[model samples]
Target chain A: MNFSSKILEDAVNEMSQLPGVGKRTALRFVLHLMRQPEQQTDQLSTALTRMRHDLKFCKKCHNVSDGDLCEICSSPKRDETIVCVVEDIRDVMAIENTSQYRGLYHVLGGKISPMDGIGPQDLKVRSLVERIKKDGVQEIIFALSPTIEGDTTNFYIFKQLEGIDIRTSTIARGIAVGDELEFADEVTLGRSIAQRVPYESSIKN
Target chain B: MNFSSKILEDAVNEMSQLPGVGKRTALRFVLHLMRQPEQQTDQLSTALTRMRHDLKFCKKCHNVSDGDLCEICSSPKRDETIVCVVEDIRDVMAIENTSQYRGLYHVLGGKISPMDGIGPQDLKVRSLVERIKKDGVQEIIFALSPTIEGDTTNFYIFKQLEGIDIRTSTIARGIAVGDELEFADEVTLGRSIAQRVPYESSIKN
Candidate 1:
């Protein structure tokens, strides 16, 4: 699209660089911003710039933070020894939102995807190992997705724990809580049956 | 969702204020920005802030511009006597993209929507009339949408141009070029039949 103003074109171009936003959507966003007060645009730009400039990564979990340690890691109430492993901070946030687990997190930054040229070394794998060896982490829970990359990363980490004295586990896989059994995929339904928990154990939760 | 950092939370809140973006989507955009180099974030913020700060509206046409007059208004090649009235700059861009209209534009800024408390006075309607009278315009085309508000705005402007010598017209309403007749809405289909042009003229176009 031909923009009449260089500034408008530049702003739309930058906005379109975001994931899921196309050129037309970017133009819409730019025009929306134009309709608002100048202060609103200033506030948005200031927040993003400051966040990018001063944002810090937690030294232990690699989650975004304002200082050396993240809020979860620094909180005394959270379980330090039971660390949940995940692909990124988004997973960390999702698991945290559940309030089901009280453990700390270990963010891998991204999964080990060979197709994307991302290997174990490209993530926080080394630091996780060092953390397991140095910290008295009793249990490491794999909370990654059920995708191939998630499985590969889980296996890679499992091998890394060969000599370590830590109990490792993965999140349960089954039909979702509210989903109909008839609609469940064949693999998931079969796995749910094969790995079925005892009635008493399942009811305990 | 709880964010680990104040900066991250603030940025997410600001980003989520945009239309159609929820908190989760905001976090995704924020994280995507976080993964990129700081320069990208700087560039985006700079472009937005600069555009908002230094942007100007064209004096003659009221379209977005960097100077007193917009590019379209200043271009001698465009027909100054034939002005196409539109709702906003986006409409202007859309018509320009067709590469068909060579007329100048008059952006109304918005349509007449009583439900939204927007009336004729809230728009650039007065200036449009002044331009038509002062520029010796021969014709004025209403390119507004077919929505109730769009029609109301067009009629209101048409009434304002009653005493003027210029002829007035609206963009044609018909089934879209590639649309199926069976799927067309009742109103559009009826309008297409009632406003049918001479077959020879339609074929020539």
Candidate 2:
């Protein structure tokens, strides 16, 4: 779109660089910023810049942190021996929100997607393996998404741990809670049936 | 959502202030920025801050401009006597893209919506009237949205120009060019039928 001011155009172009944001949406965002008080724009810019420059990744899990280690890694109560391997920090946050998992997380940064030119090396896989070895992690949970890339990354990491004496497992794949059985995808349904837990065990959980 | 880092949380919170962006989307944006090079974040922050701080509105038309007068108002090719009044700079850009209207534009910044606590006094109504009187503008075209607020704004401006000898008209309200007749709303269809043009004039245009 034709912008009347060069400054406005530059702002819109920069904003549109964001994932999923289009030029029109960026323009709307810029206009919204213009309508708001100057302090709002200043605050937004300062926060983003500060976050980018000052934020540190947890050395243990690769999750965003204020220091070398994330809150989960620094906490004494969390089960450090059982590390949940996931694609990114978002997944860590998602599991944390559930309040079901007390174990620590190892953010993979990304999965092995050959199509996107992202391999095991591009992710935090090496760091995770080193962490497992150094920390004497007993159980490694493959909590990545049930996609081809997710499976590839999980298998790659699992292969790397061939000689390590650790219990390896994947998160359960089944019909989501409150979802109808018929709505579950075929692969998930089939897997759920194949890995059916005993009635007593299910009830106990 | 539970954020591990305070800097990340602040960035997400500030980004979420943009229209239609929620906490989840904000987190995505923040994460995407984090993945990019530091230069990308710096450019985005700088562009937005500079735009908000340095952008200027045209003295003549109120459209965003680098100088005192907008390009449209300053152009010698544009007809100074006929002005198309619009809600904002976006409307100005939309009309300019059409390339059919050679007249100048007068931006009202917003419509008269009592529900939103916006009135004629809150808009550039007075400045528009003063402009028409001072510039000897012979015609005023209302190119606002076909909404109650738009119509009220138009009527308010019309009342302000009571004694002025200026011709007034509104942009046509009809079925969109590529829209099916069956899908056209009743109000637009009725107005199109009531304000039917001569067959010769319609075909000529």
Candidate 3:
């Protein structure tokens, strides 16, 4: 779309670069910003710039943090010996929201996808291995998604721990809680049946 | 949802302040930014800041611009005698995209909506009247929406143009091209029939 103003066009161009936002949505967002107080625009720009400039990555898990270690990695209450490996920080937040796991996390930053040119080396795989060996982690849980890339990443990490004494496992695949079985995909349903746990174990959660 | 990093939290809080963005979507956007190279974030932040800080409003039409006057208002190719008054810059763009109107535009910035506490005094209505008198505009077309608020704003402007020699008109309301007649609303269908023009006049377009 043609914009009358250069600055308005520039703002929309930048906004449309986001994942799901298109030109029209960007225009709407820019117009909304224009309607608000100039201070609101300043706040938004300051917050985004500050976040980008001042943000740090956790040395241990590669998650975003204010300092050397993220809250989950530094918390004494979290299980340091049992680490849950995830694709990114969003997975860390999702698992944290569940409040079911007490283990620390290893954020790979991305899955090992050959199509995207992201190999095991591109991720935080080396750091995770070094962490397990240095920290003497007892068990490593693969909490990655059920995609082929997730399986490949899990296998890659499993191979890396070949000589190590640490035990490795993946999260159980099953139908989501409160979901209808009839609507579940065949692969998931079959996997749920194959990995059926004891009634007491399932009910406990 | 809780954020592990303070910078992430601040960015998400500011992003979610946009019209349609929620906390979850804001978090998703923030995380997406975090995953990209630092330069991408810098570009986005820089563009937004520059747009907000350096943007100018057109002196005549109140539309966004880089200089004192907007592109349409400053262009000699545009018809200075006929002006289309719209509710906002988006409306001006939508009308311009049609390429049917050769006249300049006057952006009201907003419509008269009592429910939203917006009135005639809050818009650029005075400047529109001043332009018509000073520039000797022959015709004024209302390109606002067919909403009650749009009608209220139109009537308010019409009252201001009393005793003026300029001819006033509104955009026609009818079934959209390629739209099924059966799907058309009763009010729109009735208005279209009541304001029916000669077949020759309609076919000329």
Choose the strongest candidate by TM-score.
1
The list of candidate 1 runs beyond 4 A from truth reads none
DockQ of 3: 0.74
Off by over 4 Å in 2: A200-205, B203-205
Sorting all predicted structures by DockQ, with the top scorer first, yields 2, 1, 3
lDDT of 2 at B74: 87
Interface RMSD of each: 0.8, 0.7, 1.3
By summed lDDT, the worst window of 10 consecutive residues in model 1 chain B runs over: B196-205
- Provide the overall lDDT of each model, using Cα atoms, as 2-decimal numbers: 0.93, 0.93, 0.91
Q: Which model is ahead, 2 or 3, in terms of TM-score?
A: 2
Error of 2 at A137 (Å): 0.9
Which residue pairs in model 2 clash with each other?
none
> What total of clashing residue pairs does each candidate reach?
0, 0, 0
- Model 1: chain A TM-score against the true structure: 0.97
Choose 1 or 2, whichever is better by TM-score. 1
**Listed models, DockQ each:** 0.85, 0.89, 0.74
User: Residues B15-102, candidate 3, lDDT per residue (tens digit)?
Assistant: 9998899998998888788768888888888788888778889999888899999999999999999999999899888888888988
